[model samples]
Target chain A: MKVLEDRIRQEGLILSETVLKVDSFLNHQVDTELALEIGREFGRLFAGQGITKVLTIEASGIQFAMAAGIALKVPFVYAKKKKAVTQAEQMYTAPVTSFTRGETYQVSISRHYLGPDDKVLIVDDFLATGAALVGLVTIVREAGAQLAGVGCVIEKGFQEGRGLLEEMGVRVHSLARISSMAPGEVQFVDHNDPIRIKEKV
Target chain B: MKVLEDRIRQEGLILSETVLKVDSFLNHQVDTELALEIGREFGRLFAGQGITKVLTIEASGIQFAMAAGIALKVPFVYAKKKKAVTQAEQMYTAPVTSFTRGETYQVSISRHYLGPDDKVLIVDDFLATGAALVGLVTIVREAGAQLAGVGCVIEKGFQEGRGLLEEMGVRVHSLARISSMAPGEVQFVDHNDPIRIKEKV
Candidate 1:
């Protein structure tokens, strides 16, 4: 997490108080080694949970989910942003509003892939606003699958995302939690502080 | 590669002559171990190419690209389907028409991640009409980067993707090359046949 925070400080482009772009390494372009390390961290965090699957939304979250899946040695399922022509079967669906894109899109996963017999760990790149993560949680519950927890690569700690998931009784873990940020400056939630501990159960 | 071919034979649903769904293991619900193996196979194929980077389009291609990146010990960058708010810089752009989605979308990569000094290997889940791959190839070329080749997990051999890439003088390697498929039957381009060899460079 220190490494990630350091990388954020070094390479992250803070456009405003709310928009932080780690595109140089995290999402748009990726550091594969760093991604795998993030996965290992997630794996260490949730090692004993008997996770049957790793779940995430498409595009941005795929890499982290894939990495977590590799670490956990489980299959990872990404909910599609939209239903494709090939995905005509029964699906568990939810709508996610993207504040960045300023649009709401339906996220779906085939009923065939997720169901009651599985335990799921949800992963993603960023947790802000909680829009997409909330949608994924709904789908996981709808599929009758057991929720392991949410593992995020980065979390906007100042936002309502962590509050929303905790209210839903989801144990959340974020490798790097940003407490605040502005152009030319950024701050992370102190990991040593007991008051700011991430996992809720 | 034989294991991949077997997985397709066993779990692949032949939805039509053109659509073979391997969502059970490849794209939607990814088999992590198998994906790593596929990465190793790609590493073996493109080994010694001095691949500084691995590239792919977002959504489905991220997993394979990540795997290939791991195998090659290089960073990987995925082209965004559209220019996001954070992506305000100059980008290498190309438009691609998706036959399945029946729409055309512009794919772009930031000008920062790729350049003349980088050697790139493009990886993807499927090689069908070559629309996306062609767009990626164009972006790589436009970035003035050296493209080692393209590696596909599965290729619709009956389609024009390979021909298109070959026409561009790019090397193509697909783990499984399907000659034909319909309903319950599928056939692969025989690997033993020298005439069906994939690399053209």
Candidate 2:
């Protein structure tokens, strides 16, 4: 986590006093080394929690999810943004509102992928308003699967997302938590590395 | 590549003689061990080449790209499918036709991520019609970057992808080449233990 915070300070750009433009290393232009380290951290946190599947919403989330999958020796599945006709008719569907895109869209995963037996660990790149995570949780509940916990590489702790997930009683584990962002400084939430936390945030 | 051919034989589902569903292991839900092997195989193929960057498209392509990136000890940049205002305006962009979704969309990567000094190896999950590859190549060219070659896990030899790349004067390396697929039967282009090109029926 110190490595991430350091990397963020060195490479990440602050856009509009709030948005962290990690396009060089995190989301757009990926750093496999950093991702692998982040994946190992996630594995350390949730590897022993009977995680049958690691779920994430697609585009930015796939690489980190795959890294975690590799480290934990478990498979990861991402929800497709669009539903191609070739996909199965039976799916667990949910609506997600993107704070960046400023629109609501339906994302779904095939029913064949998730089952009642799965204890799912949801992971993502960023959590702002918790809309995407909420959508993912809806899909997991629809599948009758157990929500093991939610994990994120970065979390904007000043946002309402943390409280929302906590309200659902889902344990949330974020590697980097940005507690405050004023003009010049960014603060992070205090944490003791969690083996497992039942409460979300 | 025998292991890959065997995996296709055992776990692949033939749909309508044209679509072979390996999503259980290759896409959707990824098998990390198999993916790792595939990545190493790619590393062996391009070992002598100076591959500075591994470039791929987002979602399904990210997993394989990351695997190759890790094996090759290089960073990878995945071209995002969606548009965001935060991205660099001077980025190279190209349009691609998708066989799965039956649509055409544009993909782009920031000009900063790739440049004249970079030697890139483009990677993807599947190469069917070579449309996606075309888009990636266009972007790479626009950035004045040197493309070492293209690497794919599975190539549908029956399809026109290889011919298209060959016509464009690009070398392609595929682990497993499928000659034909008819519901129950899937034929592979054979190879020796060293992955030499053997006879193909």
Candidate 3:
């Protein structure tokens, strides 16, 4: 997580107190090696969970989910933001509001993919408003699958996302947790702090 | 590639003459081990090309791009279908019409990630009408980057995608090329055929 925090410090563009863009490496453009390392970290975190699947939303979360799936040696399923023409089967659906895009969209996964037999690990790039993650959690529960907790590449620790998930009794782990950030300076929660570690589970 | 072809034969649903759904493995619910094998296959195909980066459009293409980037040991960038608030910089944009979605959208990549010095390999999940691939090719050209070629997981051989890319003097390699398909039946163009081999490069 230090390497990710360092990269964030070095390359992350902080547009405002609430807007931090790691497009140079994380989302828009990606560092494949770093992504794999993040996956390994997630793999290590949830190694004994017997994860049958990795779940995420489309676009941004696909890479991290794919990486985690690779690390866990399981298939990853991404909920589509919009239902495509081909996806005409029964689906588990939940509405999510994007903090960055400022729009609410329905996220869905085919009923054929998820069932009671599956155990899912949800992964994503950023956990900010927690809206999307909340939506995914709903879908996982709706599918009757066991939740293996959430793994995030980056978490906005100041936001209500972690609080919401914890309230839902979903254990969460973020590789890089940003406590605060401004245009020129950014602060991170000490990843090794006993308090934060106790709160994570 | 044989394994990919076999997966398609076994799991692929032939929805129509034009639509072959491999979402059970390729896109929606991705088989991580198979995806890694795909990456390795792409790596073997474009091994000596000095590919500095792998590129693709967002959503479906992200997984394949990530895999290819992993195989090539390079970074990958995905063109955003919609420009986000954080992406306020100059971008290389191109319009693309989706064959499946029956819509047109502009795909954009930031100016910072691509340049003349970079060699890029564009990867995507499907090569159908070549609309999206053409858009990506235009963006890569606009960035003044050297394009190594395009690698597709599956190609609708009956479609114009390959012809369109070939017309642009671009090399393309698809792991599985489907000649035709209909409900309950699918046929693939023999990969080892000398005529197809000569045309690929």
TM-score against truth, every candidate: 0.94, 0.92, 0.94
lDDT of 2 by residue, B26-143 (tens): 8877888898888888888889789999999987888889999999999999997757746645668898988888898889888889999999999998889999998898888888
**Candidate with better TM-score, 1 vs 2:** 1
Cα deviation of B39, candidate 2, in Å: 1.0
Whole-model lDDT, model 1: 0.89
Worst window of 10 by summed lDDT in candidate 1 chain A: A192-201
lDDT of 2 by residue, A25-100 (tens): 8898889999999999999998778888889998899888888888888889889877874565577889898887
- Fnat of all models, as shown: 0.91, 0.69, 0.95
Q: In model 2, which residue pairs have backbone atoms overlapping below 3 Å? A: A170-A200, A172-A200
Q: Mind giving the per-residue lDDT tens digits that candidate 1 earns over A1-201?
A: 888988887788777778888988999889999999999999999999899999999989998998999999999999999977778788899999996788899999999899999999999999999999999999999999999999999899999999999999999999999888766777788744322211111
Model 2 lDDT at residue A1: 85
Ranking by lDDT: 3, 1, 2
In angstroms and one decimal each, the interface RMSD of every candidate reads 0.7, 1.3, 0.7
